[model samples]
Target: MSVWPAYAEIRFADYGEDFDPSVERTEMERGVPKQRLLNTDVLQTIEASVQFRSAQAVEDFERWYFIDVKRIGWFSMEHPRTGEPINARFRNGRIGRLQPLNTLFRFAKRDLVIEYVRAPQ
Candidate 1:
């Protein structure tokens, strides 16, 4: 599997953290609603933005994104919360375009909604 580019600085923003549960709720006749899990193997999603500082870092990220993940469409990176390695794909199978952090173009950032492909070890 393709690994996240080390050059990409994961300056995560203060957004929602933790995996969202995939559940199916059932309406009961006389009792509380029952919830059933839809996924047992795949875990929660990791959504965050990564920052790229420096010209070379941006170039490296472009290559990795277009070449490595273009076809396979998935990559492995450290879980933002757990710090353990996990397999994940672009959130909704797509990544948003990068934006310059400032006018100078010395920094860049992109939003990523990464869905876990499997349970983390």
Candidate 2:
């Protein structure tokens, strides 16, 4: 049985990496800056957005997101650009709707942001 929903129909709009800093900065003596690390035990949270171009893709994601009328828990996701599998969950419960001005291609698209953290070792 699959632990998570499959999104094979969804195509990634673009590939890129996003970095989230998890650090605390403090001023030390003489206006010097001192950095205190927080959540060092886990890898920095990776933020990424996925875009769905087709209605079918959006439908698939909507079903998955609204499954059982609850937000899905953390699941495994393979980074679209790096191909590195990381545990992640949807950053928000809702997906953003987008429509282009081109009337020739009236298809709407959706964007979903996901936040990834270090998977259990």
How many clashing residue pairs appear in each of the predictions shown? 1, 0
Q: Which one wins on lDDT? A: 1
For residues 1-121, what per-residue lDDT tens digits would candidate 2 score against the true structure?
1233454323444334464556789987787799876764444333334444556655676677667325746666566656787676656655555543244323544455666665334
For candidate 1, give the lDDT of residue 84. Answer: 83
Off by over 4 Å in 2: 1-15, 41-54, 98-107, 119-121
Distance from true location, Cα of 61 in model 1, Å: 1.1
CA shift at 38, candidate 1, in angstroms? 3.2
Q: What is the lDDT of residue 5 in candidate 1?
A: 80
**Candidate 1 segments whose C-alpha is farther than 4 A from its true place:** 18-20, 118-121
